[model samples]
Target: MRLTNNLLFFFILILSLYSQPVQAQSCQELETWTRLVEHEFPSVESKSVRSGSLIYNSIRFNLLSDKYFIPVFGKPFEKVGKLKKFSIKVKLTKCKKKPKFPVSKRLDWYMWGVFSQERAYNDAVKEVVLLRQLRNELPSILTKINSPMVTNDDLEDFAKIVETKFQRLLPSEINKLEKAIEKQYTIASKNQLTLAINSLKKEEASFDKLMIISKFKTDNELLLKKLDQDTRHNFFKKLAYLKTKTISELVELEEMLLPNISAVTFQDYAAINTIIDRFTTNWYPYSNLPRVEKLRNYYFELKTLLIAVNHREVIQQIINTNTLQGFKNTQEAIFKYTFSSDQIILDIKSAIVLKYRQLQLLLRIASDEVQSKSYSMATRKKLLNSVKQIQKYERVSIEGKNLINRALHKSQVLCNYIMLEELKKITEPFLSIEKKTIGDLNRLKVKIIDFKNKYKTCDGEVYDGCIKAMEGIEKNYK
Candidate 1:
């Protein structure tokens, strides 16, 4: 009777534990970790986001689901030597229309992400990177990092690679945490990227459709909504296609009928020519015509501004000011990223970025000398640039050393000595590279310095030629 009672009590206890909600659990400590990085979703109520499709909305309580994306990590992720699965998520937001899922019957623009083995692994890596970055920078940013010699992105990328590799290896510490029998069932590493991006085709179609629909204003919106989903989708697609065709035809009509219809500003002329060029490469979607409206405004704005400024100065300002428009980096569907498996590439990339910063400094100084105008000064500045380049490579060796040291320090926190010792094997080849680079840099510096000291005023003829040209001009004038 006592054994039966005890067993009954145990069964009830297990059932109660299983039924407990995640929100009810003591998850405060786990929630405190802000290191988990994932795509930020837009406000759920926003018209743009409300219309997009969602894939993982139902998995909130599953133990293996992304609901637990936070500071608290499973021990299995860090202990496994071979990372069998890596997860990737792509989330897009604020879209034109929300399509019902099971993608085949869905309307345009709402893309559902299906699992790709490569995608999953890569997405997981993004978290690994974010965690590493926060580990290094959050502390430093709170205090101060004196003009960090390395770019934050470079160091963070390297740090993630190191941490991820260490995580992959079944370390002694993980073995200590889990018994051998339980290891078979534990899911250690997983990717938790939640991408909101639907389909590019659908997004483009909806945005186009909205523009065409807007011409009707409030009158037709209700009528359009009353149409069936497929009817509305086809109507929009056909309308957008016709709009694009009409614009192309109008451009041709103007060229044929009124090729010289009132001369335009130089700015307007240039912008028109650019539009012509765009027509060749662009898909000529309905959105393309709207871009020209802003550019034409620029033409008028420049013309209006020119009323106050001289043509020479205005032209100089326009020509000399190079506009390198910034673009968001197109992250790959799956980037060919180096995993924890290759430390050498990550190490080299970090060192190169640090050294590249030094080169940029030298270039800036050289640019300053160019603006000042002195032939001898220009040569001397360039010679100094060569010296800096040598010094930059010298620093590369130092950066490599620092990278190794940082890796060791971070590893020590999560791994036992035996696990770390195994990691050291991967880095052994990199040590020789560091030593070789340092030695070569030292030798090259001496040769470069000797060359700089030997550099003479070889630009004297340039000065003499300018003086002779000035005298000839005066003589001819007199």
Candidate 2:
């Protein structure tokens, strides 16, 4: 009976040891105890069991104690083997009690062993609920931020969330998320830039093309500053290629339009001038190009052509002038200030020579009329006036003066002959003196003989005899 009582006491003591507060032992010490159990008991297998009855629980290791030997005094000291096995429950309690830092995997397992099945299931439910909440909210936080392209503002918002709310996420994990977002952003931005560059190809106007390219350059510069260095590299290279291609297209367009400048008429002066100015300004970088140079040359040539056209108009107006002096003044002005092209100058010179030839022909025709003896005094006088009128424009050519002077001399000679004939007709009535006194008879015979003799030598002295005979008749008759 005393032995039974002592056994009962010993069992109660073991129970008391098992129920001791877990704070008395460190987690490492508890882990060491579990290891010792495994090492010492070869045949006893340990089963881990966890409890979650409360917020904090113990880890229980169910171990089967192996059959052990007992010492007994029978005749002599002897060893006896106990055939019975005992189930032992080892508890590592409070292991998961709110730790200051994260628990090690082994320590976590030790703590988890203590939870009850119901408590573990409740804990799982809580975790699953929390995971579901995070999953649902995560997409809203990440995906809703600038659907395809994430801006600096969106990135800033993400940074703020990471700093304030997602601080628990590892830097590597956060970096992966950011990279994903940035990839989308890069793709979207690249698409936009590519589309814009492609749109530029359709542009027809030089000014509009330059304006769009200029603006795009500025916007791309600003956008590049926001992108990471790695992102910037591909974007820069690709966009630069696109930019170069667009600029090349613009240059080609300008080259294509260059012929229009040469074909431009006077009516297109203002519009063409604007084109020239724009090309000079925008294409300055490519000014060394042959096509660009041609554009420049064509512009100035157009200006020169304009001057020549206006000069030709002036020349045309002058050609209609009645006097040579008007043409002379205009031609002088053209030579000094207006004339530019070789073609126009040659044309104007030819026109002037033609006018000179026409005037010379008229003078020659009038001069030929003076040689005709059938011409009346009135007709001879009219010829003299026509020759004198042409003489006014004698400066039209070098040969004009000589032609005019010869024509003037011929017309004057004809006038003299006609005047001589007129004077002879006036004297015919006086030549036969039927009722004459001796002095009158002598005067009449002298007058008739003198008039006849002078008229015959009129051509040698430029008709001086006609002038003298007229003067004597007027003096004697008066």
Candidate 3:
């Protein structure tokens, strides 16, 4: 009895140790920020401590006064104060450590640093714009100084040099100057200059294929709505005509116009190419032209194609073939043609489905071997690792994760159904040899019925329920 008691005690101790939860490390930076906020904003009430499976390790706090709250990674915190009216301050330090100065003082120091840097950038932009305006007024200033007429050719040459020098500055630097000019003057040139600056910003943001696809679809829809059918058709026709025409002919036509025709229509021609690529690769072939069945279908196809080409194996293959060096040439030829986001998304979904099937295959093989007690440790490890890798690919936003989880559950249910059916098949032969073991049959019948009821609750079509049910059965049988 004492020996049994000691063994039981040991087992309980082991269980206790295993059940203890692991604590996440605190974020020193976030703690420091929190401390600073508490010190500076005494009236701001401290909220209840929020805990989850993942704890906040650290966070940077921008004290906008009365708006402070917990922040998750990658998400902007709630705005507490108006930027124009209020002076916002932030300070960073190691959590739980005593600083040389008060938190308020530290915050003030950092705020000054930030404000000074912003002032310096604004000052530089103002200087550039002032220089540009002075340069533009140079010919007039020179003529005024001489008190005689300056030749048009000399004035034009001086103006060209000034413009050339202005163009030499980076786009960002030019944008800064433009913003400074807009802030100082309320003229129409300011608005036009700001619009040009914003266009460059948009260009930088639209690099992602998904983002580009979304913008293209949005812009295309807007254009279609804005223009008449005849105008749209003519625009497309001109683009097609230009594609077939010689470069020299296009250049000659461009030269005939005061503002180059090519410059005005370049974006239109590029959009046409995108449309052509989408039709060819993503759209269903109808009379040798691409036709989309639905908007959703189009987006899905495009996303899928992009994901497929972006796969590690395909990228490695491209690198091995030394084709990546031709990126400059390929980018123009490939992306010149537009594809629908709907089509791309569809293609990505298709690839995911394929991956899901592969996982299912592995699961089935593993299950069969487990049932037979024939799978080696190495094989089991490999199967588990593959499942883990597939699970990583399944990671998305919380909503997306839920969808994937539902899909996995459905798959599991289907797997359980198959397993139960297989078990029934295997048991059929044993039934005739087991009049004495009728209790086993009764238990098996109860298990099967229980599984069916559980599956119904889980939406019988879902595989995850079936899988879970099958696992229960396996455990019970073992």
What lDDT does the true structure give each of the candidates? 0.34, 0.52, 0.39
lDDT by residue (1-478, candidate 3, tens digit) is 9999999997886564344321221334434545654443343234322321111111112332122222312222222222311222211222223454344343343233332355533443354344445445545544432333323234345445434654433333344444433332322222333343344334422123223333432544533343446655654454344333322232333235423322323224344445445544432322232222343234334433443455444322322221323433433333332353445434544554554454454444445444534323344444444445545664333443443454454444445555456556545554445343556656666665665664443344343544464456445544
Off by over 4 Å in 2: 1-132, 135-160, 168-206, 214-218, 222-275, 278-288, 312-478
lDDT of 1 by residue, 1-478 (tens): 9999999997886555444433212233222221111112223223343232331221111112223333233332223223111111111121112242212112112223322244543544454444444444433432222222323333345445434432322233223223321221111100000011112223433333444434632444544554556755655575556456545554554345333423444334444444444533333343256543443344334333322233333323332322212100111100111132334434433543454455454444444433534434344445454444545455434433443344333323222332233324323433345335555445444443433343322224433443344334334333
Clash count list over all predictions = 24, 12, 42
| Model 3 global lDDT (CA atoms, 0 to 1) | 0.39
TM-score of 2: 0.35
Descending-TM-score candidate ranking = 2, 3, 1
lDDT of 2 at 466: 57
- What would the TM-score be for candidate 3 when compared with the true structure? 0.18
Q: How close is each model in CA RMSD to the real structure?
A: 40.5, 23.4, 40.1
Of candidate 3, the 10-residue stretch with the lowest lDDT total is 52-61
Candidate 2's C-alpha lDDT? 0.52
